[model samples]
Target: MKTQKAIYQSSLPSNTRNKLVLRRTRKRFNPKIFINRTIETTAIVSLLFTGFTGAGAMGCWGMEIAMSSRNWQHQKNICLGMMLVSFSGFLGSALIGASFSIQRDKF
Candidate 1:
């Protein structure tokens, strides 16, 4: 039907996707092969890690809020742990950004 055809069309790969490409390493698992690219990858991974950790922290915070009604110390501890993890992830991301900033500069 028309709706099915529309869905199929929408599912097709985007033709206007980002044209920029990440530089590849000369050798697999070899950071020296592409020092700049290695830093780029590290920064990207750090960002992803921070995002996941932040999400976890948010969930823990929600749980803590729910348990606040019951005055449960366990939930507070769990939330604290998650917040630490999130903070660590954010710190890691910041470190990676500071270390690899030169990689993002134009030649």
Candidate 2:
């Protein structure tokens, strides 16, 4: 029995052991929230757009303007927030667009 436990313990790498410990510790102390796949995908797409726009804005307008006019620590954060907003907009538009694009057959 001792040997079985020893073998099991030895099989886990230190990083895996650390991660398991961290998970257990977090479960005891925190309320775990998981984002659904659709939400995650939407966030990613939004962020991508936000980043693209923000970077384009920065290049066109200059970082100094972003820093002086905005309180965001970096242009990146501003970009991220814009991304989230765009994502939300896109998610709504996609749902509507999808509904419109669907074809129904009438007998």
lDDT of 2 by residue, 31-69 (tens): 222323454566567667866876755663565565564
lDDT of 1 by residue, 20-53 (tens): 3333334335554476565557656656665665
Instruction: Give stretches of model 2 more than 4 Å off.
Output: 1-48, 54-74, 103-107
lDDT of 1: 0.56
Structural similarity to truth (TM-score) of each candidate: 0.40, 0.31
RMSD of each: 15.5, 15.8
TM-score result, candidate 1? 0.40
Misplaced by over 4 Å in model 1 are 1-33, 69-107
Clashing pairs in 1: none
TM-score of 2: 0.31
lDDT of 1 at 9: 36
Cα lDDT over the full model 2:
0.54
